[model samples]
Target: MPPFSRVTVIGLGLIGSSIARGVRAHMTGVGLTGYDADPQVRETAKAIGLCDDVADSAGAAVTDADLVILCVPVGAIGDAAREFAEDLPADAVVSDVGSCKESVVTALREALPGVAIVPAHPVAGTERSGPEAGFAQLFHNRWCILTPPADADPLAVERVAEFWKRLGADIEMMEPAHHDRVLAVTSHLPHLIAYTIVGTASDLEEVTSSEVIKYSAGGFRDFTRIAASDPTMWRDVFLSNREAVLDMLQRFSEDLSALQRAIRWGKGEELFDLFTRTRAVRRSVIEQGQDDAREDFGRAHD
Candidate 1:
C-alpha cells in the first residue's frame, strides 16, 4: 500500500514541485495537491499539471490532505503551517524540507499543536529555483533525514520514511540538534564559503568583474554555481541554524589561520600533507557514490 493517499505540498518551488512530480511518477494512486504564496507560481504549477489540484490558498490545499509537506524557506515554515493550521486534518502528518531540523521541528510543533509532525531534510537540490526546475529524479540517490520529536508517533515517522523511499530516497533517522550540526559542517558551511569566495572576488579592486568572469578557472566557476543559489532560501537557512553554523564557522576560521601560517613560513611539507588528506576525502566521497568520479566532475564541453 502507498504510504499516503493524498499529499499536499505548500510552496511550489523546486523541491515542492519535484515532490509533486515524484509522486505522479512513483505513486499513481496518490492524490497530489499543491499551493504557493505567489499567484504566478500557482498558475505555473497548474499550467504544467504539477499536481492533481492546485489550490489557491494554503488552507484550502491541506483541507483533505493526509500528508502536508511544507517546502517553504526555513524562516517561513511556521507562518506557512499556521496559515493552514485550522484547515489541516486532525490525522494528517505535517513535515517540511528545510535544511535546519531543530528550528523547523520547534516551529511546526508550535504552529500546529498536537499534529503528527515529522521534520525531514531531503539533502538534495540544485542551484535553481521555481516550479520549472524540479525533476522526479532529483532524490534518486539522495539522503532524506527524518528528525521527529521524541514524543512523535512511530507510525507517522515510518510512513514519512516510506514516502521518501518510494520517491527514490534513502532514509536516515537523526536527532534534530545532531542533524543541524552535521549539516552545518557538511552542507551549510560549504555554501557559506562558496558565497564568501565569490563575493570576495567580485569586490577585489585589482580585478574587474568582467576580467573575473572572462578568465574564470574551474574552481571559481564551481564556487559561482554554489553562490548563485537562491538568496532568500539561504538567508533563512543561515539564520535558522545560526548556532551550529556559527560554531562550525569558528572552527573553520581556526583551521584557515593554520593554513595561512603554513603558506607564510614556506612549509611545503605541511601544505602537501593537508592537500593529500583532503584529496583522499574527495576520493572517498566518490567511492561512496555521493559524487561523480569523472574528470571535471562529469562536465561536458563542446
Candidate 2:
C-alpha cells in the first residue's frame, strides 16, 4: 500500500521536484501537488509537468494532502509551516527535508502545535538547484534519516519512512539533537571546509582568479563542487545548527593545528599514520557503498 495517496510538496527546488518525479515514477496512483514562493519557479514546475497541480499558495497546495513535505530552507521552515497551518488537513503528516533536525523540530512544533510533524533529512543531493535539476533517481539507495518527536504518532512516523522507502531510500530513526550532531560531523562540517577553501583560494592576493581556475587540481575541483551548493540553503543550515556545527568546528581546528605542528617538526611517522588511517576510512566508505570505488571517483574523462 502507498504511504500517501495525496502528496503536496511546498517548494519546487531540486529536492521538491525530485520527490514529485519519484512519486510519479514509483507511485503512479498517488496525487502530487507542488508550490513555490517564487512565481518563476512555479511556472517552471508547471512547464515541466512536475506535479498534477501547481498551487499558487501554500495553503491551497496542501488542502487535500495526506503528506506535506516542506522543501524550503531551514530558516524558512517555521514560516512555511505557519503559512498553511490553518488550511492543513487535521490528519495530515507534516515532514521536511532540512539538514538540521533539532532546530527544525522546534520550529515545526512551534508553527503547528497539533500537527504530526516528522522531520526528515534525505542525506542525498548534488550541487544543483531549481526544478530542472531534479530527477527520480536522486534518492535511490540514499539514507533518509527521520527524527520524529517523542510524542509523535507512531503510525505517522512509519508512514513517512515507508514513503521514502517507496522513493528508493533507506530509512533510519534518530533523536533530533543526535541527528544534528552526527550530520555536523558528516555533512555540515565538510561543506563548511569546502566553502572556506574555495573562498580563500578566490581571495588569495598572490593567485589571480583566472590562474586559480585554470590550474585547479582534482581536490580543488571537488571542493568547488561542494562549495557551489545553494547558498541560501547552506546559510540557513549553518545558522540553524550553529551549536553542533561550532562544536565540530572547534574540534577540527584543534586537529588541524596538531597536523601543522607535525609538518613543521618533520614528524613523518605521525603524518604517515594519520594518512594511513584516513585512507582506511575512505576504503570503508566505499566498502559500505557510500561512494564509488572506481578510479578518480568514477569520473569519466572523454
Candidate 3:
C-alpha cells in the first residue's frame, strides 16, 4: 500500500499540479485534492482535471488528507498553514515543496505546532508557471532534499521520504539551516544573478535592444529564461530566504570584484584558472546526472 491514501495539495501552480500528476501516474490508489489561492487557477485546475478534486477553500482540501503538501511560495507557507490549520487532521503529516527550509520549518512549527512538518525542496522545475505547464515526469530523476526537524516523528519522515521516492525522486536528508545555506549558493544566487543581468540588459535596451534580442541566441537567452520565471514567486523566494541569500550575495560580490581586478590587470592566468575550475564543476554536474552533457546545450533535446 502507498504511504498516503490521500494527498492534499495547496496551490495549483506548476509544482502542485506536477505532484498531482505524478501521484496519478505512480501511486495508483492514492487520491489527490488541490486548492489554489486564486479562483481562476482553481477553475483552470478543475477544467484540466489537475486533481481528483479542486477544493474551493484551502481548509476544505485538507479536511481528510493523510498527507497534506503545501506547494505555495516559501513566504506564504505560514499564511497557508494558518488557513488550513483548523481543518488539518490531528495526525496528518504536513510537508511543503518550498526552496528554502529554515524559514519554512520555523513558520510551520509556529503556525501548526504538534503537526508533522517536514520541509522538502524538489530540485526540479523549468522557467514555467501555471498548472498547464507541469508534467508527470517533472520530478523524475530529480533530487528531493528533505529537511526534517530533529524532534520530528521518524515514521512521518520515512513516510514522506517513501512518498517522494514513489514519485521517481531521489530523497536526500539535510539540516534545515544547512539546506538554506547550500541552496543560497546553488539556486538562490544564480537566480539573483540572472535577474540582475537580465534587468541590466533591459535597462540598456534603448542602446542595444535589437542587438540584444538578435544575438541572444544561446547563452544570453538562457539567462533570460531564468530571469523570465514568475516574478512574484522569485520575489517571494528571495525575500523569504533573505539572510542566506544576502550572505551568498556578499561572497559573490567579493568574487566579482576579484574577477574585475584580474581583467583590469590583464591576469590571463587567473582568468584561465577560474574558467578551468568552473568548467570541471560543470563536468561533475553532468557526470552525476544532474544535467545533460550534450553539446547543443539543452536546445536539441527540448
Candidate 4:
C-alpha cells in the first residue's frame, strides 16, 4: 500500500506519539504533522523529530492529510473532530485511537459527513502518559480493533487497516457497539475496580497504609499499577462508555457477591470451583500469549 502521504496526528500523547514513531519508521514517504493542546508535548515532539511539522491547531494539521488520527482523551474526540471537520481533505480518512469506540463514532460521524471515518482502538498501553512515554514498539503484536460504520468506504477501511498493519498491530473489524461492550468487560470494568481498590487502600489510616504498602503482594499491588494510569483518560473512558461499563459492572458485582457469600458461609467446594475456573482463565490468557509472566512489577506501589 502507498504511504498515507500526509498524515495528521491530533493530540500527541502516548498513543499518538507512538503512532508517529511507527508511521515514520514504517511508511517512508509519509509526511507527518502533529497537534496537541499541551504546548510542552508539541514542543517535545517537535524537538524529538516525531513529526515533520507541529501545527498549532487540529485544522492546520489536517489541511491536506490523507489520514487524520485523533488521539485525544475519549471525551475530547468530538470537539477535535469538529475542529477540523470542514478542513479535512476530501479523500482524507479520519480515524481515532480513542479507547472507547461507540462514543467516538457518534462524535466524529456527526462532524465529518463525506470523509471516511474509521474508528480504531489500539489495545496496548503503559501506566505512563504523554509523548515521553511513547515507544515505536507499543503497537507491536498488539490488537488494534477497528469499528467501521456500515456505509464507510471499503477502500478507506482497507487503507486504514493497512496503515495500522504497518505499525505491527494485528487488526480485527467489528461494529462500534460490539467493540464498546467487549472492551467494557475486558478493559473498563477492570480499570474501574483497580481505581476503586487502590483508592480504598489510600484512605486507610497512616499506620495501616504503611503496612498495606509494605505487604501489598497478595494482589492489591496489581490493582495499584493499573490505577496509576492517566486520570483524565480513564475518567473520560468511564463517562463516555457509561452504558457498557455499567452493564459489565452489574455482572461483575453479582459474581463478587457470590464469592463473598462463599467465604461468609465457609463453602470450601464453592470457593475451590470459583478459583479453579478463574485459574483456567489465566491459563488460557497465557496460552494465547497475552499474560504478563514476569511478576516483575509486584512492588511498584502507589
Candidate 5:
C-alpha cells in the first residue's frame, strides 16, 4: 500500500510534477494534489494531468493532505510552508525536495512549528524544468536522502522514506548538517565548476558564439548540459548552503592549483594517477546503476 493516500505537492515544477506523476503511476488510489506560485505553472500542470487537482492556492492544496512535499528552491522552503501553514493538518508530514537540507530543515521547522518536518533530496533530475518536463521514471534507481531533524518523529521519517521508496528511489538517512556537507562536494561543486567553465567559454573574446556552439563536442558539451540547469534553483542552493559550498569551493581551488602546477611542470604521472582514480569512480557509478555508460551518458537512449 502507498504510505500516504492524500499527498499535496507545492511548486509544480519538474520535481514536484514528477513526484505527482510517479505517485499516480506506482501508487494506486493515492490522492495527489498540486499548487505552484505561478499561475501559468498551475495551468500547465492541470493540462498535463500532473496531479489530480491543480489548486488555486497553497492552503487549498494541503487542506486534507497527509503528506505535503515542498518542491521549491532551497531558500523558499520557509516561505512556501508559511503560505499554507494554517491549512496543514496536524498529522500531515511535511517534507521537501530541496538540495540543501540543513537550511531547509531549519526553515520548515521554524515556519511550521510543531509539525513533522522530514527534509529529503532526491538525487535525480535532468537539465529540464516545468510541469511538461517531468516524467514518472525520473526517480527510478536514484538515491533519495532524508535528513530529519534531531527531534523529528521516527514514524514520520519512516513514512517519508517509504513514500520515496515507492517512487523507485533508494532511501538513505543522515543528519541535516552532514547531508549539506556531503552534497557540497558531490553536487554543488560540480554544478559550480560547470557554470564557471561554460561562462568562460561564452565570454571568450577570441571565440564567437557560433564557433563555441559548433566546436562543442565532448567535455565542453557535457559542462554545458549541467550549466543549462534551472538557474533559480541553483542560485538558491548556493546561497542557502553558502557555508558548505564555500568550504568545498576552497578545497576545489586548492586541487585545481595543484593540477595547474603539475601541468606547468609537465608532471604526466601525477595527471595520469588522478585520471585513473576518477575513471574508477565513473565505473563504480555505472556498476551501481546510478548512471548509464552508453553514449551521451544514456541521454540518447533514454
Candidate 6:
C-alpha cells in the first residue's frame, strides 16, 4: 500500500546495485539493504554506498524488508527464495530481476508460499557484470516486463509496478509463458547466435583473427559485444531456460538453412526479400530510439 520503508536486495551486482541507486535517488522514504553471496561484490556495494546497509546473508537483508528483490542468476532464484522464505516479513513483497519469468516464478512459488512473488525482467542489461558496472539510468526508458500470476493481488502488483516506474522503466504485464516465448525469440536466440559466431572467430588463426578484430565494422562486432557477457551467467541462462531456447534455436537453424540455399542457388530475390524484412525491423527499433549508435559501446561498458 504505502511506499516501502525497508527494501532488501539480494545479489548486489549490477542489476541490484542499479536498483539501489535508482531507489536512493527517487524513492525518498525507502531504506535500502543489500546482500551478495560474493564477498567482493558485498564489499564493493558498501564501499560505494549503494545501499543504507549491506548484510552478510539473505535472511538478514530481508528480515524487516517490505520489498525484497532477488538479483542473482536465474538458476539461483529458488535457492535465494528458500534461504529467506521463513524470515520474510509477513506482508513483504518478493520480486526478482531474472531474465526468464516462468522458471523464476516456479522457483519462487515453490519456495515462498503465499508471499507475493512478482517476476520482473528488466530488458536492459549490458555485457558487463558486478556492482561497478551499474548506473542509476540503466533502466531509463527500458521495458520492465512483470509476469504476475492470474490470481496475484492487484495491490501487490501495483506496488511493484510503481517501484519500477519510479526507476524509469516503462512497465508491461504479460503471462509468464508469453513472456518467455517472446524473449526466446527476441533475446535468447540472438545471444546463442552471437556465442556461436564468436566461438567460430576465436578458432581462427591468430593472424587472421587479429585482422578480423581490427576491421569488424557492424554485424560481426555486434555479435562480439553480446558474446562478451559473463560466461557463467549466460551458461546458467541457457541451461535453465533450455526448452524455449532450443525451440527458437531449431527454428533459427531452419531459417539459416533456407538462407544458405537461396545464396547457393543464386536466388537474389529471396535473399533481397529476407534482407529487406530484417532491415525494416531494425528501422522500427531505431524509430523507437532503442537502437542508438552507441548501443555497442554502451553494452561493452555497462
Which regions of candidate 1 fall more than 4 Å away from where they truly are? Answer: none
Tell me how many clashing residue pairs each candidate has: 0, 0, 0, 0, 0, 0
| Per-model CA lDDT versus the true structure | 0.95, 0.95, 0.91, 0.89, 0.91, 0.88
Per-residue lDDT value at 181 in model 5? 92
lDDT of 3 by residue, 18-110 (tens): 999999999997999999999999999999988889998989999999999988988899999999999999999999999888888999999
Which portions of model 5 miss their true places by more than 4 Å?
Answer: 299-302
- Which residue pairs show collisions in model 6? none
Candidate RMSDs in Å, in order, are: 0.7, 0.8, 1.4, 2.3, 1.5, 2.6
Using all chains and alpha carbons, the TM-scores for the candidates as numbered come to 0.99, 0.99, 0.97, 0.95, 0.97, 0.94
- TM-score-best of 1 and 5: 1
lDDT of 3: 0.91
Which ten contiguous residues of candidate 6 have the minimum total lDDT? 293-302
Model 6, residue 264: C-alpha shift (Å): 1.0
RMSD of 6: 2.6
Q: Please, what are the lDDT tens digits per residue for candidate 4 over residues 1-302?
A: 55488899998998999999998888888899999998999899989989999999878889889999999999998888899887888888889999998888998988777778899999999999999789889998899999999998999899989889999999999889899999999999999999998888878885588887888877777787899999999999999999999999999999999989999999999999888999889878867867565455233545
Task: For residues 45-103, write the lDDT of model 5, one tens digit per residue.
Answer: 88877888889999999999999999988888899999999998999999999999888
**Between the candidate structures 4 and 5, which one is better when assessed by lDDT?**
5
**Residue 249's C-alpha lDDT in candidate 3?**
98
Candidate 1 lands at a TM-score of: 0.99
Model 2 is weakest, by summed lDDT over 10 consecutive residues, at 210-219
Task: Assess the local accuracy of residue 107 in candidate 1 as a C-alpha lDDT between 0 and 100.
Answer: 92
